[model samples]
Target chain A: MNAVVLSPVDLAIAAALIVLLAALSLRLRLGVERQLLVSAARTTVQLLLIALVLKVLFEHAHLHWVALMAAVMILAAGREVSARQKHRLAGWWGYGIGTASMFLSSFTVTVLALLAVIGNDPWYAPQYAIPLLGMVLGNTMNGIALGLDRLTLDAVQRRAVIEARLALGERWQQAIAESRHEAMRVGLIPIINAMAAAGIVSLPGMMTGQILAGAPPLEAAKYQILVMFLIAGGTGLGTLVAVSLAARRLFDERHRLRPERVGSRP
Target chain B: MPVLELDALATRHVGPLDLRIDAGECVCLQGPSGSGKSLLLRALADLDPHAGEVRLDGVACSAMPAPQWRRRVVLVAAESQWWHARVGAHFPPGFDPAQLSAVDLPPAALDWEVVRCSTGERQRLALLRALALQPAALLLDEPTGNLDAGSCAAVEALIAAYRHAHAAAVLWVSHDARQAARVAQRCLTLHDGRFMAGVPAAEAPA
Candidate 1:
């Protein structure tokens, strides 16, 4: 089969349409719709642009581009997610957690899926590396954002118990432990909910994509398992980065919960 | 014995509120509704920002980290509202929330789903969680405010047990003078964002 490609015109039109749709939804005060739409559109535009660049990049097989792309994606994802969660963006952990998560998940999936399974050449395969990493990093971004939001909100709601913990001589980290768990639950809930609703309520994008790409049902089923594992890996890594890594930010220099940063939407 | 001093604490429509409760003592705060009886305690805990200091064990709470300060100073509400998802899920490993049963909380409460808890159950559960932590000072914002007379007395006894076991000072805020007298060794009446400790010993919790 001829390699599938999105023409630049088609890509641009899709991007413009998505932006318009997001704007309209935002105007309607449908925040969740706006969040999903904007994220999807941004991901689409970003992936398509990177695809074009990677096509040229693969021809050269330069290691610098691969490393640079990974770094850029990590920073970009971290920054956007931290920005999205705004006030709750706790310290430098966002960077560490985001980077660690993307590396652990994307590389793990890449290694497992390719070396152990497909047996593809490991030397600079843009096709597998870029797309798969994007999926991992993108979902991780959302996880971090959601975790931060929930954690901070929990801090507010669970103030009494948290303070009680502190009064018992528990350190700031320990005091917020239960609250952090709440945030983790909040962060992890979507994946669990999605898993629950998977297949019956909705066909997940990955499984559907594999099916549409002309893979046989069993082959697609295998891919689905792999994707699910990767997603699980990514979610775990993301939650760690978001919850623990965000720890430094939750407590101030004196280990007290700082008043949240002003001017946050989340 | 340590004391909790809310020093010149003021917030929007709240306080310039000031008072102190020594270690192993109970100080009651009385005020009409919207008079910031609860708000004062919330501000002292630094859950909300206010202009003032909360001193504990002779250390200026403002200077100490809020989390550190909070760990030493706990607040229990009348209807303890901070209960989490599952009663058991909310507690960490090994703080046997089972002991809450002595306080009229169910033994199974530690495992009961949080969403199913009634208002009174939530209050008791929050208290249990706080007591489990064994704070140095307990700030009770009318912890029995929602219960009936008999239930209120039962909660008071539970608190008495908690305080005796821990030797923790208690600052109990209430609208009832009789309840205040029963629960607190000393009472501080709040009016117009300030406190009148009434008598010298009222500054001390027994």
Candidate 2:
């Protein structure tokens, strides 16, 4: 199969479709015309910049550059996770936990896949390592965010129940066991659903992109499966780390629930 | 000997005073709503921030781990929280069914879902749950507030029996003066952040 490259004029023609969608939203008084235009502009600029960076990265192929890029990605993902939280750990704790969890889960999983599973010629090859890391990190960050948010919220809302258990001579782990389970479950749900619906409900983005670039359908599906498994493992590990850390953070050393540590929220 | 002692206990809103309850003694604490009555109990239970020291039978609260201290000096809040779907799940393993009978609950009540339990049943069961731990001291906050007169009498009797058997110290918070008079060996009123000898004239029931 041969892939077709779109020139600038072809790209302009594709961009026209977004303008048409925005105009239709305006006509229907849907009130998202401005948002649609801003999002479209941002998507265009961000993707182009990322494309240029990736091109440069692939050409250079230095270990230090790869490490720097990975760090930047993890940091941005951590910030995204922290910003989505309603009740979060105070000060730098939320950001620190998110970044650390992603680094441990996604980075480790990606390295293992590159070196051991795929056994690529150069383990940190930007062509494979960067894209795979991006997918795993994205999913892991979401999982950590969801788990942390759920854990914090439950810690605050269910203080009475947790304390009742503590009063009953149960350890801190036993007291918040239910909440911990729930938070991890919430974190894993998205990935679980994606896994279940992968080929049938939707052709996943990575697989579709590969097939669009003229990779064989079967080859693309195999790669997609590997990516999915890596994502699932990364998410599970990240969520476990996040919820465990969060549950511990919600209490003091003596097993008292300190909702103040998460700071006050209405 | 005093089973529980608070040395100059001061929270943000109340205290900075000292008190003690001897073994087998039930001391009633009466105060208006939001006068820091619950806060005092919470502080005693090591659930709230406070200054000064709390000790159980010469063992400082700070000395023991929190879970151990909490087990010995338990606080039963007015609105008890039931986490498990089934009533029995909340209790510890090998908990005696006979304990439930002491609180006027049937043995089969253990199998009942917590959501199906009546407010009175929950109140009684919560008390039983606390007592089952064999705590040395109890910080009870309106333990029978939702109970009828007969249930209230039953709870008081059960508490009395337990206190006598174990020589446990109890800090019972109640708004009913007559109930306090009947249950407490001595009553202390929280007035303007201070513990007075008896119920204030305004708060004292006729």
Candidate 3:
């Protein structure tokens, strides 16, 4: 019961389907034909590049190589988080807060899972560590980005209400409390929906992949459950940290509502 | 000692000026639009970034926590803002119902939804909201800008009562020269970012 290997021609068949979809988009005058084709190309290039990197990484499996890879992954995720924002915190804060929170939450959660739950030898084994960290970081990145985007945009749009509260002598924390909670809720919505719909509404991608690769159904299901919990914990903690830090940055020590600190996309 | 003192207070467009208002005194500030009238009040309330010293009873603004300082020196902005659904939610517990009637609002106004209130009503409620804190100094940015003749008189009378009862120092910003003459102990006009002895309300253009 070994899994059948996919040749280049087999993948080409999948690529042909994408070309067909792009043709349909073009015929419909849906302006997305170019974006669809380009994104499909990017997916092929990016995944193939990562596959090569993973091959080298698996053969070496040294702690240093794994740490370097993790650093690169987190940095890229941080940039994505910043780019997703409509009104990002100005200067370094635009990039730093999301990056720092993702690093803290995803790294801690992945390491804990490796050391205590899975108990992999050397704990930083690239086989276990890389995939787990990638999964957690990816989810955490989305949460932090959503949380931060919501927070900064809300702070700007609700500037008058916030300052009014501030004028009435409410502390900065109290003034921005509702916006913070709202941002956190928005960030967590995706992961919550995914968890709720998993295995029933749709088979989760990781579980399907594992089962397709010939792992027993029950073993793949157990791994999928663990991954889901890890993602949930990582995302929740990351969003909480990112939103809190971003909220604090929206005001100064004098508790003034500094909407200017959150700059709009130029 | 003066209840509110500004020394070299400056924001981007206003001040680096000096002024004082003793307890129970009202100073009317007048200027054309964009002359930084609101900025001055915001600076005094520590709601905007500004330079120089502001003192309440000789206590420097920087010496106290911002919220504490703001609690003692409240600002009522020109346009009122309400975050709660019910008007009562914005008020503190044990707020005097008499204050509502003093502003000509029914006691039941508290239970009304904020969205249901008119611009003038919200303005009056905003003033009451600030007064409920019983601040020692008040920064009123066109507190009656939205009110009719009757509502404006009611607001002025209510402010006068509050000031006398609490010995609060008041800096009232207004465009109406007659209203300034009616409510202010001294009037000053901000021109080119500095205060000048105001022209007589009658002589001054409307």
Q: Pick the candidate with the highest DockQ.
A: 3
Q: Ranking under lDDT, best-scoring first?
A: 3, 2, 1
State the C-alpha RMSD over the true interface residues for candidate 2, after superposing those residues: 1.2
| True contacts recovered per prediction | 0.33, 0.67, 0.89
lDDT tens digits, residue span B1-206, model 3:
33899999999879898998899999899988887888899999998899999999999999999999999999999999999899999999998776699889999999999999999999999999999998999999999999999999999999999899899999999998889888887888998787877655555554
DockQ of each: 0.23, 0.72, 0.91
Tens digit of per-residue lDDT, candidate 1, span A43-147: 878877877888887886666787788778777876776667645544555455555655665566655665666665754466666666777667666776788
**Chain A only: TM-score of every candidate?**
0.73, 0.97, 0.98
CAPRI accuracy category, model 3: high
Better of 1 and 3 by DockQ: 3
TM-score: model 3 vs. ground truth: 0.98
TM-score of each: 0.61, 0.96, 0.98
Interface RMSD of each: 4.3, 1.2, 0.5
Q: List the residue pairs that clash in candidate 2.
A: none
Interface RMSD of 1: 4.3
Q: For residues B1-206, write the lDDT of model 2, one tens digit per residue.
A: 43899899998778887988999989899878777898898888887777899989998988998889888998999999998799998777788887777778889888999999999999999998888788999999999999998888899999999999999999999998888878887788887678877643344564
Please list the C-alpha lDDT of all candidates, in the order they appear. 0.69, 0.89, 0.93
Q: What is model 2's native contact fraction? A: 0.67
